[model samples]
Target: MEQNWDDLRLFLAVAREESLSGAGKLLRLDPATLGRRMARLEKSLQTVLFVKSPQGYALTEAGSDLMQRAERAEQAMRAATAGVPVQSDQLTGQIRVGAPDGAANYLLPQVCAAIAAENPGLDVQIVALPRVFNLSRREADMAIGVSAPTAGRLVVQKVTDYHLHLAAAESYLAQHPEVSAVTDLQGHRMVGYIPDMIFDRELDYLADLGVGRVALASNSVSVQVRMIQQGGGIGVAHDFSLAATPGVRRILTDAVSLKRAFYLIRHADDRRNARLAAFAEALAVGLRAETARLEAATAGQAAPKA
Candidate 1:
């Protein structure tokens, strides 16, 4: 019995998703049917590919080895079709990108919208979550991260560097003590990421300000910005985000400034995929332009009168 390409495709999906239901969802097959097909594949190979457990499917050692080869085969198949004629700008496939809520909510919507407008056939799905995504598990085809990852067979491209500063709503600034220096932040109520839920060290914005706690905290960036907008308190906020948000103004521009960069991450194998490469370039270019365009608003808004 020989291994079939379609069977290998299904096997790869199961290995990545780690469960019948997860793989079924991605492949659009019922769990029972997927299980039956997996059983058939195992029978042909005369090996147990997965061990069932409470956590779902755990790939056997043999299965892990097979996964590597299957991935190579998948890449080869994609490369084979690279020479086929297609519209240069029109891409037709689903690409899922995961990012922390800040960029996902504020930046990506505009960047992706523009790409989709140009490539009408491209289906872009954005997953906004506070924590880092597991790219190896196929949680997303690509991810945007605040920091570059050190481990994983992944390709990382630094997208852009942006700035952040302590900010608060005009109404809050009016009622609170003036923030002329970092020392002034001591008595003010602060709103920022939940102390423990800060996903990346770079996101520990408040702590960098020498503050340890938040008067009001949420894991979501959009929520923190809303808290600032509602005059909750001063928080370190992205200048790009503050531009889109009304009523929020930056404070202590010279004293409490922060710089951060965004990185675009993809599987090591995806470098061979032409479509993904093109999409990645477009996204990176769009982000650089968008960040510059939005940060311009920061130039016009006067720092609060101290």
Candidate 2:
């Protein structure tokens, strides 16, 4: 049996997306055509590639095995078709980066914009979600996670250590009782993640505070920060985010400091792609620098003690 590069390409897409419709969107082909092509590929190889169901397509063991091989073939095809030097130079394709909303709103927009400016031909897409990305499903080419992942066929790199501090809008601080210390937080309205929706332990910023009430709560970092920016209530806010949220200021300067790290997560196999590797390196470096610079700017704000 013989196969072509296009056949392998189609198989890889279906395997990654786990649905003909999903693969069709990526390939700009209809699901029916994709289904027929998938059938032909399976017949040529004489193996069951995917188990189809009402829910969606699921890769069989044989399909998973072929996907791994096909990706390598795909890499070679790209490199051979165009001199690999194209990858070494300007990155000329789209890279989808999934990240938590805090980093997405406060950090990535600027950093990715800068990277895109540098690589004029590159298109950078940022996907902001509250939970861990499904990297195995190709939901994103890479992800920025608040904590390092311990298991998976993934490469995790520590991006940066960032700080968060209890903060409130200046207007809210002016209207409420002064909170000079952590002990003073009792009875004060708070803004925080909905306790049950906290996706990661590191994000449970208010867990230790023992605040009596959370007046405002949300799963989105952006929403929580915006709430504080709009004088909703006192809450822990990223130093980087505070720099951008002009109305909000850190309180209890000597207390309630939280440190967390960001990790750059990628598929282990993606490390072999020079273009992606270069972009990942650039992203990690830019993110670290941007986080530091913004945090420093926040620290320098004249009325940091809200």
Best by TM-score: 1
Q: Assess every candidate by TM-score.
A: 0.93, 0.88
Q: How many clashes show up in model 2?
A: 0
Off by over 4 Å in 2: 26-28, 43-48, 60-83, 304-306
Candidate 1, after superposition: displacement of residue 150 in Å?
1.9
lDDT of 1 by residue, 104-172 (tens): 988899999999999888899999999999887778889999999999999999999999988899999
Q: In model 2, how large is the Cα lDDT of residue 73?
A: 91
lDDT of each: 0.89, 0.88
lDDT of 2 by residue, 1-306 (tens): 657988998898898888999999878899999999999898889999999999899989999888888888976775564435663477878899999999999999999999998999999989999999988777889999999899898999999999999999989988999888798888588999998888899887776877757779999988998999998889998999988888888888687888999999998867777788889999999999999999999999997432
Error of 1 at 250 (Å): 0.5
- Residue 125 lDDT in candidate 2: 88
